[model samples]
Target: MTAADGSRLYGSDASTADQREALLSGEVPVAVYGLGKMGLPLAAVYADVTGDVVGADVDEGVVEAVNAGECHVESEPGLSELVERTVAAGAFEATADPRAAAERAAIHVVIVPTPITDEKEADLSALESVARDVGAELDTGDAVFVECTVPPRTCADLLEPMLAEEAGHDAFGLAFCPERTASGRALADIRGAYPKVVGGVDDESTRVAELVYGELTDNDVLAVGDATTAECVKVFEGLYRDVNIALANELATFADEIGVDVNEAIETANTQPFCDLHDPGPGVGGHCIPYYPYFVINGFETEAPLLRTAREVNDSMPAFTVNTLAREVRAEGGDLADATVAILGLTYRPGVEETRATPAGPIAEELAAAGAEVVAVDPLLDDADEFVAEMIPQRALYDPDRDLDAVVLVTPHEAFDDIEWERFDPLVVVDGRQYLDLSDTDHRVYTVGSGVTSAGRAESAEPHRDANLAAEVER
Candidate 1:
């Protein structure tokens, strides 16, 4: 397929209309690298639009599953069906060989992981490996889009030259069109939950990206100045959340000291439109928020006091949660060292199995160090082997023989809402996410940002006799 036949869109004299038609008609074959959580949905969407796409992954199992039209990634609403449909229609396929996919494809999209090292620096090894594979067989007029989140200057300084060197020429198009999709709603986000952002190393690259994504997404494609700007857009979005949550966590720490309910104050203050405070919880979990600040702070030589401070504040929250649990247990005439504490919901977010940088890990460690017997309840995970707690099903947590001195709700999973708070005897309950409403119960509830709510003594209250029996259990 030649440029004259409308097969190549980048660096071509073809009109925008012709380029759009070529992209949608599958004349400009697309190859997507990294078929993980974000990448699979992206490849499926590209296939759905272009009718010709190939996804490449290093994991043999992942490639095999995709080749069999099965999605290994879970919790994505419509990804499995999309993958099956695309593969069955011969519009999309998966391969273990990246070189084979790159050789025939005119458009390359890289959505590999850019995780942080233990030293808090951006780890682009995965991205670099994928880029080298794509670049090895990249044609003169081919287009490459980096949709993974990375440091601002990563594409402009690193990948651009790296890919050019591997390709032995600088005739290709390179752009950064970072994925703005979340975990559970990948299909909606990819199809058009938000406007797509596109920026290239040069003008032609930007134009090519705009044309391709314009058809892929229902929303507008925002063409920015350069690739670095697009990278900054994604990183800045996460940094804003990290810093904002840090501010909220700092304010929540003052709830008891200031003798006022900060949650109520924050909720009321946010009604003024200028204020957009995030909720303070046990800590900020999930892979994105906790690691994005480092992409800026460590990537540059400039001193970012605010970013560093935010990181410190957010990191301290897990320990603060454990300390609060200890203090509250003491107030209830029980020692944390001798108490049986149960941690509810181990996953970072409610229903997903993504535990990367989850606060539950640190919370469990702290509870163990303090000599508390920690038992975890999470239906999403089969076992708590990674955590320092005894893994127990949600139903077994309410057994009459098992007495819990305290409970910390690290993640406010919808499953936890069905918990029978009255089953347990009057105990210390630290609502880490402030999701519990134990005002009417005998248990003393201490919400993260709210002061302790007294639930009166059980002077004449009878023990819950049918706590285990005659009730429907759900997780």
Candidate 2:
């Protein structure tokens, strides 16, 4: 069969075996819109599986790079090699024109940005723009899949009607197949590190989605009730992390007052099958966790008190980290107002280059505002001109004559594991991630969710007796 003949699966009379065969051959062409980090990996995997796919991006540089057999996205394990192989084998190519790619494909997948506005409303501008392009050349039997996360009901309430209007008819299939992937492990996540979730506007859309992803992934395909449910699956996953991390952070704040190691307690409590608590950190960074809560809090009229409180708690952590540093400096007979502090690891995570809502920005700003001179060091990021603190290379950060009064371990990259703590004079150290083992050093240390250490000794903490032992002794 030619590329167009018997390739359409939306309303085809072909058998399931025949449809899968057609998709595996070069007959059923696929177009993936928005070739960003997640999008590129998705497109490459589609090309590898389907043998005919086009990646669409508005950025000319990205298109040129992909067309020339190069991957612009970094830190993904096998994406670079996959893109090169797919492009060289004629199984994949990229284009700046979405309309052209849509015209030749039986399936169009969109994974564009859905950023929030300044007022914290879900911005669907990029998604809508790509939807219009897909609709302009939309065929009757073609199917559209949305793999990006948005507020729930976006597919049913907004995208379906908009696509129908633009296409001048509603014969096409539409589904919400959210991208359940992470930045550093996109390929594994896409190719079935987890079960694929698919929901649709109608039965045919759901069937088509199940068929497509069933072939693409090695894991099982979960067909939900509708598109909104699939959207919620993605958003709710992030929201759960946000709330859990907030609880961990709130508990961490009580370590000093309660005189117990909250991190250790959390780790011990999680041994029970019923309990699963996340680690406490300086703040919730990364794009997914920080913004997903707002989708629920502001998307609907219903009040989300728990989500709002979680956001407030997580947002307050950066300031809390700074305050902890200031108090530690005072205990060390040094004033933050006359100190030069250094922030290590500016990115949200250790190895990834992304920094959408990283806590380092606020930490630096608060430290500088309190009259402390701040310098930041990150191995991944090349540009720090926008940071409130001076940007120093990682090599220069450990210079003996650097004149640093305090240090905060923010991201805890692997490069910091071998640092010689005795190279410099004693300074106040705040372990924001619970990553440092500086208890043996001369530096005074304060670990979040753990108590303080001074010159290889823990500060005096009030001890509590076990309830069972206390009752037995009193009897």
Candidate 3:
């Protein structure tokens, strides 16, 4: 960009003072593409920080909902009210035309999903598609920020060239600022919590990204070496969790073998500062952990044997859970093929409605394939159309005369607490995530990660648990 253009736009002068004044005066307009779960909260935060913001998405329903001041996104705290207030104040608006929104806005942010293909390759199609639209409306010194979690080198090696080709101008600034927030606390994370990591294709792009985020977040903006490093930050975070959880799950398998309580050991071990372990469960789910490993596994030529092994360990959890279920059913003098099973919790996480890559789907499918009748229940999920299991509401789940051959606690939402678990007589129970205390129930229960068996609950090898109980009783 020429000196005159630098003086006119944020790319040229990304100083905090200049950007702050520009945002307040409505001179530097902001456009956020993708208005889904994370996108809407981010757009709302932008509106709260800046005076004017446009939210763009291909989904017409989302566009209409935002335009009508109704939050289509579900279960997000304070998001509906934030959207209503922002729309009411005219600081935020939703649009279907990305090109139009991009043209009018000086800061164009992309928060689209980067799903992995069936072959486990990173699917940048959505990100590429949005970049093309953003490029179409780009002008000299216009800033484009990618907030999608992507494989390293995607921002500098892929997006920069792609945007340039589409825009016919290499002058448009590009930055990679990975979205670090989860679905439940997106607004809070975006507003503060973790410091935002920003890296750009060039020095100018880096400066512009830092300036814009400095105004949007109350937290400090950490400028990394380049866009690839920023990409690495997000992917590494997910990768670490995936491997850590895999380790825990692997250890959980030893409970039955070693005849000891693994969770009790883990709980005691975690008291020390160095032993930071992820919880073991039916499986690791969600859009992030399960998919991010594939980013490295398939993106480049280098082999990720450890990552591949971790994926295998996590992927096997569903079947392992089913195996435990089958044993319990057989112990009760019945085969799994002839028994009825109830799979509880469909969402990957509790209190959130997101179902992307949730392990509950696989657990339900496996049970059905094993010839057992499966009924799935979750307070957050009313529709289990994606799976073969019969989806029932919480009320129907707790029928007084209900009897199932087996029950597998998959996601374990808090709503399950309302159910009188003692009301049902069961011979088989599989507690994923170790959410149940089988010692109190008559059924032969198997708690995942606790090393407990269907015959009896496992005992801890260490005296830490006993010490804690004694300490608490004395107090």
Candidate 4:
């Protein structure tokens, strides 16, 4: 396709103006496979931009939900309205048949999950299945792009050959453009907020993919050398953040050992022009930060010592939080074996309901395994069952009138800022995320990485709970 400025956007032998004109004229459709969190919003954005969009997924419930103008994923905002408008405009529809979706579109986008196997290997089963489905309806000039986060060379070395074998073609136009959208801000990010990176098997394929994304966003579209480079870009971006977080956690631990205030140290350090450090937390979680680095190391068979060590350091944080809680319980003269430990926050991070790779999961499991009566609560999760089932939702957590030994703050949800500190009567509060201010509170508060102490009753200062001293302790 050629632009009005006489610049040829695609390679010389690529699809001509006829295809572009057909697309703009609502003749050439766009299809998106795997209508999950990323895929559904991407399909909605495309439907909003163009008049023809088809969404396909393996889950019939998801397809039906979208078709009925509803969103099953809580991360998406105003998704129901978008789906209703698109469906009413006759520009968007969802189905379970991948082949049908592929046949109806000239450009196909795959946003399926590339999860890791039990052995920590790159599991390409979902990507391979979608490629086979797309190949079944692959035409000579059809353009295909993978928007999923994958390991280096995954698109060029693994997916390309798979698509070729399935489609019975020697070559096809294909590219890899990793998604950089956040969970809550996906709609805006996908629309035009961030730059788009396009890398393809050939110049023609790169151009085709760039033109496709260019139509959606006005942001800068960069064309890298090949799919391998594009894939590495995303991995590096995520792994770098993970390593930095690990550093923050390690420093926080040292601050606790030295009886220094970590928050003050981090604040002072951040004032320097060259320093851009993140805060320490209970643990690293979320779909991207915790898992993306492993994909690179596992797929490429390279020794990423720092990256692997960073993952381990972050992963070990929950256990450390648990151990800290146990120690505090003992210091408070309370035996954790029979104490009721209330956990605040279950989602991975704040302000969103996605719980994939949430650190709270491991923290809760470890707390329960340690023989504590773990009563978990989060403003996002409605009930204990739902919290145990989905681990995240929009409803507030239930607060029962029961005495507690300690409360662990894992996620710093905004709503938690409003909670009354007096509710946990005489409870020890362990601020894992540093979400609380305990300066004025009479209760004992222990913060991770912040070695601050508070005045406690004599019974609490002992090594175990003394029922005799409880009568003397003021509520």
User: Which one is best on lDDT?
Assistant: 2
Tens-digit lDDT string for candidate 2 (422-441): 88789888899989887677
In order, the Cα lDDT scores of the candidates are 0.85, 0.87, 0.81, 0.76
| lDDT (10s digit) by residue, model 3, range 330-366 | 6567899998788788889998987778888778777
**Candidate 3, lDDT over the whole model:** 0.81
Cα distance off (Å), candidate 2, residue 417: 1.1
Angstrom error of the Cα, residue 282, model 4: value is: 0.6
Check candidate 2 and list the clashing pairs: none
Where is model 4 more than 4 Å wrong at Cα?
A: 1-21, 384-397, 455-475
Which of the two, 2 or 3, has more TM-score?
2
Weakest lDDT window of 10 consecutive positions for candidate 2 = 464-473
Worst lDDT run of 10 residues, candidate 4, spans 1-10
TM per candidate comes to 0.92, 0.94, 0.91, 0.89
What TM-score would you give candidate 2 relative to the actual structure? 0.94
Residue 16 accuracy (lDDT) in model 3: 66
